[model samples]
Target: MAGAEWESLEQCLEKNLPLADLREVKRILYGKETRELHLPSGAFEAASKGDFELRGYGFEAAEEQQRRPRIVRVGLVQNRTPLPTDTPVVKQVTALHRRIEAITEVAATCGVNIICFQEAWTMPFAFCTRERLPWTEFAESAEDGPTIRFCQELARKHDMVVVSPILERDAEHGDVLWNTAVVISNSGAVLGKTRKNHIPRVGDFNESTYYMEGNLGHPVFQTQFGRIAVNICYGRHHPLNWLMYSINGAEIIFNPSATVGALSESLWPIEARNAAIANHCFTCAINRVGEERFPNEFTSGDGKKAHRDFGYFYGSSYVAAPDGSRTPGLSRNRDGLLVTELDLNLCRQMTGRYKMYARELTEAVKPNYSPNIMKE
Candidate 1:
């Protein structure tokens, strides 16, 4: 079948596919809902016994029983691939290093305590080709990769926590590959790692071609500022993935992604925000900006070119707080940073002390049936 013909068929099938709840969409367009998420009393002190004020970001609450609000200034970079379309893998990595240096400098001046990079920040979104040459060669040992060392240098220099997402090559485990995130603490120590749990097999996102499902369970690292976790890329779509991080006591979760405008742009904003409010944790979504044109035309085994350009990776990176208030997103066409403040106490506010209205689309939409993904 022709590619366009297949698209038409898929669209026809999708019209009745039932993922779209028109009432919910209508409610989303017409309604104004509060986004406050609940945090049980004394959750901050309970999350950690270490002195949070020693870092110079918090203070004691007026009441002796109450802990002071923990504020973390986090910076998220929405960057474009810094190298040209035809650069060598080595040069591409070098260019990315320089780009992050510049961005992190700005973040430091703004007093950001923690910062996150976009998904696979060192490489282009070239997995659509499914060709193994230089792309596969871009993978590196997550723990000892040059990129990890590079971010560690900056982390130590700025005293900032750096979350770097990349393609990882694990030699100890049969040299298997995975999409991974490395957490570098403020003192340049490698805190730990989390592999992306979900790999997208739909359309051109065939990330499973390069790696299998992540084996490491959800982990939230204890940092100087707070407990944090990384839900790399496609994991953002799975509500359970976000819930696991929250369940593990993560106050903030950074979702580093590389998604184009043509695919799930509308859902991009809703999913992350809903997760933050639902899971009662701060959520940050960071997408790479700009279009990446691969060196050669590629085909999806379909007699025609699947895509010469992978389309624009619209970068609208933003941070959503537990209370549902969020900073405005960054630019779609430019490299940008969102340096925003987070009061971790909102995640631990006294239950029922504040009656913030959250959007209840359940009443507006039809009674839902479980999909197989949800059923199993």
Candidate 2:
């Protein structure tokens, strides 16, 4: 099926639903004070013209006697591929650069202190095809790839920290590839990189065919905004993945993902909200929008007919707070930017009293494991 037909089917399915308004659901799940922020008039006009949803929300923090509030605005970008999957790699990269740069410029206007794009935001979602030729060509150096270079320029121009998730081609380590998120500081310095800890083998998500589980453990990058970490895609399903990042001193965690609606839409809002409440840290979950069509057919090993598309991605990208409060997500069908203002002091306030309990519990787990079995 073509992309337009798939989208029309999605619309038909959505119109028959009895689901509540997402904003109302979030307000009830979080508190009444979990309200929206009104952006400048120009921002609204730009979103309307660009055909992308733009929203802003603020998470309030309690008054602290000792420390002042550390406020930072964060932007999350969820977009579709600008070109066809069969496009040349250089042209694909160039088109994506131009597209993301426009969105980043809008984010800068909102005074965003930090920004993040969805998983593999530069290219089409081609892992389903499993072709080693052009798909693997998307993998580039995490340190100085075209994607990172473009992001560096954006970060420097806006003085905003950028979390760029890309397929990485490691030159030093036998040219192995990894699904990685590269952190670029506000000064445009290459801070460090973290690989995806979990690889999904479910359905058409054959990510493990491209790269193995990451070697780098959960390491938090301290930026000018706050101490942040990236939990790429499938890692969001693991509670331990969320816990380890918090244990490593990550105040905010971004899960850059590209999951289809049919497979994991039900669990989308639940996991990140649960993680925020459980870990006592902010969680930002992002997913790309729109349906991507591939040139060849693929199967999910479920006795179903081979298909060319992976269904709709359902881009309801959201930000969950440490106090279980969250902002309403972007639309499921269009490109979007979710701008949220977070007070970093809230993490400390929520987690301060419970830190000892978490530490003790984690320490207690060490003795339960058998020493005879090698750790994974």
Candidate 3:
């Protein structure tokens, strides 16, 4: 589809929801349980004129005598590389920083408490090319990398927690690389980080050539907004990855990813939504948009001819609440920001209703499984 058509469709869907009861329209198009929030007029105007798409949704839970409602607004950003993948590392990084910075400024106007970027937001999704030198150049120290420093400033300025997924270079440990996400607190302090537990070798996702499995296990960071965790990229395909984050007391889990349409588009919506329902926690699935072409041709090892680019990175970023209800996703082909307000109390409400004793079940089933295979 053309760019203009996609923008028109996005605006129509976003505007029509607030104008009328579109339950039937939503049921026919977006899922039946989807809900949207009416945002300020300035947000829509910003999206109409800016370089990115904007959307908002709100989820609520029942009131209680013991505790008040804990509403936290979250922002998920999906964007394409502003420059070509073959551009110089510094130039490419600078272009991405500018793109994300502008979108984030708009998110701050929407009063987002926490915001997350698509996986490898500072660089192109070039791992599929499997060429080492230039791609490896993108990896940097998570503690004080240029990307983290940029995000820290925005977090501090907006008083919003930021989840930044990047290719981490463990400078202290032989400069080993890991797929990691750094969590910046609202105060701009580095709360902690989580590394992707699973790596993919499927299709053109030649990720193992770049980095091995991560050393850091699932660790949740307690930010000023809420307790959250990052399940970076391929880790979303693993059920245990999601379960462990919930076990670590993560109220919200962000899955920052760089996936293409041909490989996992069908599984994209299902996994995160299912995880939220089963784990009793919120899940934000963020993916970059647009196609990224490389200088050299590469093969997927699937008997297909070599190509210069992987398939399109479908955006479709969205948030799923613990009650199995989700907000509509961002555009599949445009740079977009999805803003949603969630009640953390919904996790507790769902927990009481589901009554799935995951801890007990795991304890009872652990002995029967092989000890070596069960080791984390």
Top model by lDDT, which number? 2
**Which portions of model 1 show Cα errors greater than 4 Å?**
1-65, 300-305, 349-376
Q: List the residue pairs that clash in candidate 1.
A: 35-323, 39-347
| TM-score for candidate 3 | 0.88
Residues 257-323 of candidate 1 have per-residue lDDT tens digits of: 9987667677877888888887888899998877788888766544665567776777778777675
| 196: Cα error in model 1, Å | 0.3
Candidate 3 has an lDDT of 0.85
Tell me how many clashing residue pairs each candidate has: 2, 0, 0
Candidate 2 versus the native: TM-score?
0.88
What tens-digit string does per-residue lDDT give for candidate 3 at 1-376? 2332344333577676763556666554445364577778888788778767888888878889998899899999999898988789999999888888888888999999999998878888888888887999999989999999998999999999999999899999899888899999999999988888999988888889888998888899998788999999888888889988998899999999999777787888789988898888999999988888889999988999999988888888989878777887788888899999999998952334223556556665886754435445
Give the TM-scores of the predictions, in the order they appear.
0.76, 0.88, 0.88
Instruction: Show the lowest summed lDDT stretch of 10 residues, model 3.
Output: 1-10
Ranking by lDDT: 2, 3, 1
Consecutive 10-residue window with the lowest summed lDDT within model 1: 51-60
Q: Please provide, for model 2 over 79-161, each residue's C-alpha lDDT reduced to its tens digit, 9 standing for 90 to 100.
A: 98988888899898899888888888888888899899999887888888888888988889998988899899998999999
What is the model-wide C-alpha lDDT for candidate 1? Answer: 0.76
Q: Rate the local accuracy (lDDT) of all candidates.
A: 0.76, 0.86, 0.85
